[model samples]
Target chain A: MSQKEDLSLFVREALLAGRPRPEIAEVLVVAGWSQGEVDEALSAWAETPFAVPVPRPRTVVSARDFFVYALTFVALGIAAFHVVWLGFLVVEMLWPDSDGANYWQAREARNSIAAILVAAPLYAWLTVRERRRLAADPGLYRSAIRKWTTYVTLLIAALVFVIDLIVALASFLNGELTGVFVAKVVIVAVVSGVLFAFYLRDTDRG
Target chain B: MNRVLFALMGLIGVVAVGTGLFVFGGPGTARAEREDQDRLMAVNDLARAISCAYDTAVLPEAIGVTSFSDACRPTNLRVSASQLMAGGLLTYRRLSDHRFQICVIVHDLGRSLNSAPYSDMTAGPEGAACLTRDMQG
Candidate 1:
C-alpha cells in the first residue's frame, strides 16, 4: 500500500481501538509525519460510525448517464457559441464601418439565432431532466466523466478569460479601443466569468 | 409526469416546425435584405466620392472624368456587387452638369429607398429600375 493508504489504515485502526483522533494525529506528527499529513490521514475515518471501513460502491456510468452528459455538454457548447456570436453582432451594430452593415453580419446573426433557437430549449429540457435525476439520487454527482467535463470547462473558461484580457490590452495599446472592441472584450469576459462561476460552484458542491 | 413530457415534446415539435419554416422561407427575404444593404453602402460611398470630386473640380470638362472614379474609391470601401459598378446589375452615370443617375435592378420595388441619407434620391419611371440624385458644386 502507498504511504497515504498505510496512514489511512493506521488511522482507521487507531480510531477502532478507541484512540482519540487528536492523540493519534499527535503521535503521527511526532513520528515524523507532517501535521497536515496526519490530519489528512485522520480525516479518512472522521465520519465512520463503525470500527470496520465501509466499501464505497464503484461508480458505474451507464449508457443513460453518458447520454445525459453528452447532451448537456453539447447544449452548453452551442449556448456558448451563440453568446459569442451575439457579442460579435452587437459589436458590428455598434461600430459599423463607414459603408454600413454587410452581408456577413446578417448571415452570422441568422445562423447563431437559428442554432440558439434549436439548442436552448433542448438544453433546458435536458438540464431539467438531469436535475430531477440528481434530486432523486445525489450520488449521480460522483460520475467521474461529469466531474472531469466540468473541470475541463472551468479550465477552458479560465484560458478564455486570460486571452480576452490580453486581447483587450493589445487593442488598447494599438489605439484600436473602439466601441466594438470594448463590447467584444466585455462579452467574452462576462461569458467566461459566468461559466467559471457555475463550474466552480458545481465543483465546490460536489 | 407524462403530461409534462408530452408538453415538452409538443413544444419541441413547434420550435422545429417554426425553425424549418423560417429556414426554408428566409433565403429570399435574406437575399433581398442583403442586396438592399449592399446597395445602400455602395450608394453612400459613391455619393460621398461624387460630392468630393464635384467640389474639387475647377472646370466642367473635368466633371465625371477618371478623377471622379478615383474619388469614388475610398481606402476602406469595397463594392462587391458587380451591379453597383462595371455595368452588371446597376449603372452609375453622369447625366449632364451636376446631375447623376444610379440605375439598379431591384427585385423588391416595394422596399422604400427613401430612408435617411438616401431620402434625397428620387425614383425614375414607375416600373423602371433607376434612381436620380443631383450633386451640388
Candidate 2:
C-alpha cells in the first residue's frame, strides 16, 4: 500500500480502538503523518468501500480532439494577424505614415482582442488538461498548489506569446510589414513553439 | 447511482458520435465537402474583396473560404493549435489599391502589420481575431 493508504489503515484501526477523531488527527500529525494521509484514511474507513460503488473510469477529451481544436485556434490567429498587417500596409500606403488618434485607438483594440482570444483558449486548455490529469492520478495531483502553479505557468507562456504578437502587430500597424517584420515573427513563433511542446509533456509527469 | 450512470452514458454518447464522424466518414464526405466549400468560399471572398492590393493574373474572386470543414472553428480557436499554424500560413493583403501588405501572420500576436502600437491587444495563439478577415473570413 502507498504511504497514504497505509496511514489511513493505521488511523482507522486506532480510531476504532476508542480514540476520538481529534485525538487521532493530533496523534497522526504528531507522528509526522501528512494531513493528506490522515484525511484519506479517515474518509475511507468512514465509508465502506463495498457500500459505495467504485468510480468508473471517465473518458475525457481524446488526444486527437484536443489536437484538432488546438490546430484551428492557431491557424485562425495566424491568418487574422496577417490580414490586419496587410490592412495597415494598404492604409499606410494610401495615407501618410501619421501617428494619429484613430490609429492608436484601433491598435489598442487589436491588442486587447488578441489577448482575450489567446488567453481565453490557453486557459481553457489548461483547465481541460488539469481535469484530465487529476482524474488520471489523484495522488500526483493532490498538491493543489503545484497543480495550479503549473496551469498559471502555462498561461504565462501564452501571455508572452500574446505580448510578442502585439509587438509584431504594432510593427505592422506602424507600416513595418517588411521582410524584417516577418523575420521577427518567425523567430518568436519558433521559440514559443518549442517551449509549449516541452512544457506540456514535462508538467504531467511531474 | 442512476444519475452518475446517466451522466457517464451521456458523455460516452457524445464521444461516440464525434469519433464516428472522424473514422467512418468517407474521405471528404458530404459534411466534410460542404465544410470545405464554406471555408473556401469565405477565403475566396476575402481574397476578392482586396484583390486590388495584389498583383497577379488577378484570379476572379474565387470562393475558397467556403471550404473550411466544420472542424475549423473549434480547432482553430485553441492556443496550442494556433501555435502550430503560425509556422505554415501565408497570405497577402492590400493596404489600399495603391499599396500592398504581405504579412506572414505568425502565431505570436493578433495585431496589424503597420507601425501603430496595439497596446490593448490580447494577442495569443488561440485566435486569429485581427488577421482572419483576409482571403478567408
Considering every candidate listed, which one attains the maximal lDDT? 1
List model 2 lDDT by residue over A1-206, tens digit each: 88766775676567557666778888888999788867665665543344332332323445554454455345334433433343333333333333322333343334434443454345445545655765687664445455344455466557767887888889889987766456556545544543444345546545
Report the error of model 2 at residue A153, Å: 7.0
Q: Per-residue CA lDDT of candidate 1, range A1-206, in tens?
A: 89988887888788778887779988898889998898767655545577565445445567777787778788877867675765566455546552333345546666776777777778778877876887798888878767777788889889999999999999899998987778778878877776677667678646
Expressed between 0 and 1, the share of native interface contacts present in candidate 2 is 0.00
Going through the candidates in the order shown, the clash numbers are 1, 75
Question: What C-alpha lDDT, on a 0 to 100 scale, does residue A57 get in candidate 1?
Answer: 41
Candidate 2 lDDT over B38-113, as tens digits, reads 3333333343344433333233332233333443333332122223234444233444333432223332232232
Best by DockQ: 1
TM-scores for all predictions? 0.53, 0.24
CA shift of A134, model 2, Å: 14
Runs off by more than 4 Å, candidate 1? A1-53, A96-98, B1-31, B34-102, B105-137
**Model 2 spans with C-alpha error above 4 angstroms:** A12-19, A35-150, A157-206, B1-137
